[model samples]
Target: MTYSKLNISTPSLIINKNNLLSNINKMNNFSKKNKINIRPHSKSHKMIKIAKTQLKYGACGICVATLYEAEKMVENKIKGVLLTTPITNIKDKVRLKNLFKLSDSFMIVIDNIYSINFLSNIVKPLRKKINVLVDCDIMYIGKNKISRTGARSIKEIISLAKIINQNKYMNFRGITAYAGDIQHINNYNKRSNEAKVRYNYLKNIIISLKNNNLDPEIISGGGTGSHELDAKSKLFTELQPGSYIFNDVEYNNVSIYKSNNKHFSPALIIGTSVISRINKKQYVVDAGLKAISADSNLMPLPIEPTPIGTKYSFLGDEHGKITLPKSSKIELSLGDKVYIQPAHCDPTINLYDKCLILDENKSIKTWNIDARGYG
Candidate 1:
C-alpha cells in the first residue's frame, strides 16, 4: 500500500485519507449540531469514495456545479443531487431527463421563463416532474441591497416560480442563493456581517413567497469559506459547502477559521522530484504550471518548509525553480522527492489522471479523480 509499492512515478497528487476524514466529520457534525442539512459540493473532490464518505458522515445529499458532474455522481449511486448551475441546451435537457429516471431525487437551478419552459417541455412528455430551485442573485450592491448573484432578477424568479406552480411537469422546490464573493473577505467579522446581509435579503424573499402561499422547502446556499457563518445564520436550511473536505491555501488563509495558531490540515499535495540544480543556492522540480494550479495567488507549500532563504517560482510549462540561500544547510539532490501543496485543488486535480490516496505514512491507495475534465 505504500508509494514505492504502487509502481507510480513522482509528480502525482497524493490525498491524505486521515486528514480528509477528519474534515468531513467536522463539517458533518457541525451541520447536525445546528440542525442543518449538509450537502457538500462534489466538484471539489470529484471522487466517488469521497462522496460516499460525505453521505456516511450525515450529508443529506451532494451538490454539483455541472450536468457532467451530476452524471459522474449518479454512476457512484449518489441519490440526491442539487445542480447549482443553470442547464438550458436541448441535449442537456434530454440527458437530465434520463438522469431523473435513474436518480431518487434531483433538482436544478432556473432563472428565467425560457429555462423553466424548456425544462417543463422536456419533463412533460416523460410524465415526470423536475424539481426546480430559484437561483437568487446575492451580490452586494453597496447600499445594503443584495442584487442577483448570477441567475435572473427577483421578478424573474417569481415569474418562473409562477410558471412552475401552474405547470404539471415542474415542481418549485425553493431558492439557491450563493454569495461566493464574500467567502474569503480576510476578516471574519466583516465577512460574517456581509453574509448576513445576503442572508437577510434571501430570507425576505422567502417570506414574500410564503405570503403568496409558496412554501420554500429548501433554502440552500453557502460555500466552504462561509459554512460557519451560514450555518448559524438561520436563513439557510441546507448548506452546500464544498472545499471543506480538502481545503486549499486560499481557504486556509481566511480569518474566521484561523485561530490563535491552529489551522485545517491540507489534505492534498503534489509529489515532485528535483530534476536539476543550477547552483548551490538554486534548484528546479519536475512540477510546473501544468502540474499545479496557482489561481489562489501562491506557490505550493513545500511538505517540509523550504530553508529560510529559499523560494519557489514557476519556470515554464514543465519546470519550477527553487532559489536557495548560499549559506543554507539544506541541499536538495537530484531525484529527491518533495511534496507540494497546490494553491487550488480543483483545477490542479483535473490535470491528473488519478489521485494517490495515502495514509499517515504516505502509503498509496488508488482513488480515481473520476469526474476530472468534465468541462
Candidate 2:
C-alpha cells in the first residue's frame, strides 16, 4: 500500500477516503438539521464504495442520471435508486424492470405525456407501479424565453400528474425541478436569489397541485452549488447533492458550504509524473487531453504551490507543458510524482479503470470504479 510499492506507470485516480467520509457525514448532518432527507446523486462518483458510504452517512437513497447507471448500482446491491432521467426506450424499460426485481424502491423523472404513457403501458403488463417525477427546466431556452422545465409547463406537469394518478400502473411521486445551469453562479447573492426564484416557481406548482387534491410526497432538486440554499428554502423535502462528496475545481470556486473547522477537501486527484522536461521555463507531464478532462474552464495545476510565474498548459494529446520560473526551487526531475486536481471529477474518473483509495499518509487501497464503464 506504500507509494513505492504501488504501480504508478498507468494513469491513476486517487480518492482520499477520509475526506470522502467526512464530506458524507457533513452533508448528512446538514440534512438532519434541516429535517430533509439526503438522496445524493450517484453520477458524481459512479463507484459502489462511495455510494455505500453515502448510505452509511444516512442517505435515504442514491440518484442517477440514466437507467444504465441504475442497473449497475442495483447489481452492486445499492438500494433505493432514483433515476433522474426519463425512461424512453423499450430496451431501457426492460432493464428498469430487471432493476425493480432487485431494488426495493426505484424512481424516474418524466417531462412529457408520451413518457408517462409509455411507462404506464410497460409497467401495467408487469402489474407494478413505477414512481415518477416531473422534471422542470428553470433556465431560459434562448433570448429571455422561459424554457419548459421537462414537463414543459406548470399546466403540463399537473396534467401529467393527473394522468399518472388515473393510471393504476404508475405512481405520482412528485416533481424534480433541477436548476443545473445556476449551480456555478459566481455571485453568491445572485445565485441564491436565482435559485430562490426557481424554488418558488416549483413551490407554487406544488400549492396548485394540493389545491386540486393532489399531494406530492417528494420535491427534489438542487446540486452541490445550491444544496444549502435548497435546504434552507424549505422547498424540497429531500436534497440530491452529488458533487459535495468530492468538491472539484469547478465547485470550489463558488461553494457556500465553507468551514472554519474542516472543509470538504478534494478527494479525487490524477497522479501524473514529469515525463519530459523541455526547458528551464517549460516541462511536460504524461497526462493531457486523453488522460484528464479540462471542460471546467482550465487544466489541472500541481497540488503544492508552484514557483511564481509558473503555468501548466494542455499540450496536444498526451503532454502538458509546465512553464517553470527562472528562480524556481522545484526540482521536478524525471519520474517525480505530480498530483493533479482534475477540472471535472466525474468524467475524469470515468476514464480510469479503478481509483486508488488513500489514507492520510498516502498509502493506497484500490476500489474498482464499478460503474465507470456502465454507459
Candidate 3:
C-alpha cells in the first residue's frame, strides 16, 4: 500500500523527497561550478541513504563528527571518510585501527601533537598510514574569543606538521581552518568579511607551510553558512558543508541566500499529532523537546495546520504547545497531524532512530538513521 504524510505515525522525522533532492543538486552544482570538492558533512543527516545521495550528486567524500559515524559509513562501503573531530580516547583507538583497515581513504583532523602521537602509535603498529589534517583556529586575537578547534598559531601548526611528517605512519594531508562562530552571524556582510579574514589567515598559514617545505593539498573546512565565501576564496581545495542538505530555522534566519531560492529548502520535518485542545487557539502536540531538538533556541514552526501567526512552544519532553490567533481560519481537532520544521536539523535528527522518507508522489518509505546515537 502507498502511504502519504497523513499515514505516517506521529512524532516521526520526515524527509521531503523533492526538497531533499533539490538541496543535494544545488550544493553539488555549486561545488562543481566553483571547482571545489564538496565533502558534505554526514553529521547533519546521519543516514546512509542521504550520504549516498550526496556522493551520487558529486560529493568527493563524507565528513563525520565522530569516529562511530566514520565506522558506520565504512560499514556501508562508503570510502573517503574524514573524522572532523580530534579523537584522544584510548578506548576508541582499537576502533580507529579497524577503521583504517576497512577504508583506504580515511583521514582524521588533529589540532595538537598529542592527538597526532595518539593516532600515530596505533597506525604504526598496524603498519598503516593515516592521512591527518591540522585543524587551525582562524579566529584572531581579541576579535573572536570563542574557540572551536584547531592550532592557535602558525608556529604551532608548523610544529605539529613536523611531527606528523616525521612519523612513518602519518601522512600530512592538509589544513582545516574553519571559522565556525562566524557562520551564524546574521548579517551577510559581517559573515563574509569575517570569512575573508579567516581565509586570509588560513592563506598565510598555507604559505608558511609551503615555505617550510610542507604543502597542504587539502585546505578544507566550511559550513552551510560560509560555503559561498569559502568557495570563492580559492584557498580551500575541499569544502565541508553539512547542513545545506536540510536547512533548519536557525540556518534559514541567517541564510546568505533567501529561503525562497530553490537551491536549499527545509526538507526535514517532525510530524506531531494534536493530543489535547485547551481552547480554540491553544492545542498541545505529542512532540516537544524529545522529538524536536531545542538546542538552537529556535522553536519549530507549524507547517500542516500552518495558519498565519501560528506559533509553537515546547511544553515539555512529550508535549508541544501550538497557539493560533483567536480568529484564525485554520481549524484542527485532536489527532490531527501537524508537521514541525525543526530549528536545528543535526541534533533533531539524532533524536530519532528512523525517518519517514516522503517522495514526490506522496509515497513514503523508511530510512534508518544508522549513525544516530553512535556519536
The candidate scoring highest on lDDT is 3
lDDT of 2 by residue, 266-329 (tens): 8787777778988765778888887788777855655654554666678978887777767786
The Cα error of candidate 1 at residue 176, in Å, is 0.6
Ranking of all predicted structures according to lDDT, beginning with the best and ending with the worst: 3, 1, 2
Q: What's each prediction's TM-score? A: 0.92, 0.92, 0.95
Task: Compare the candidates by TM-score and give the number of the best one.
Answer: 3
Model 3 agreement with the true structure over 1-375: per-residue lDDT tens digits: 122237867899989888899989998888889999999899998889999999999999999999889999999988789888899899888998999888879989999878987988888777878899888888643266778778899999999988888889889898887777877886777787777777777888999999998999898888888888788788989988888888888887785653334336889988888899998888999998899998887778776546767889999989999898777976678888778899889999999999988887777899999998854
What is candidate 3's CA lDDT for residue 30?
88
TM-score for candidate 1, please give it: 0.92
TM-score for candidate 3, residues paired by index: 0.95
- Predictions in order: lDDT: 0.78, 0.77, 0.85
TM-score of 2: 0.92
Model 2 deviation from the true structure expressed as Cα RMSD, one decimal place: 2.7
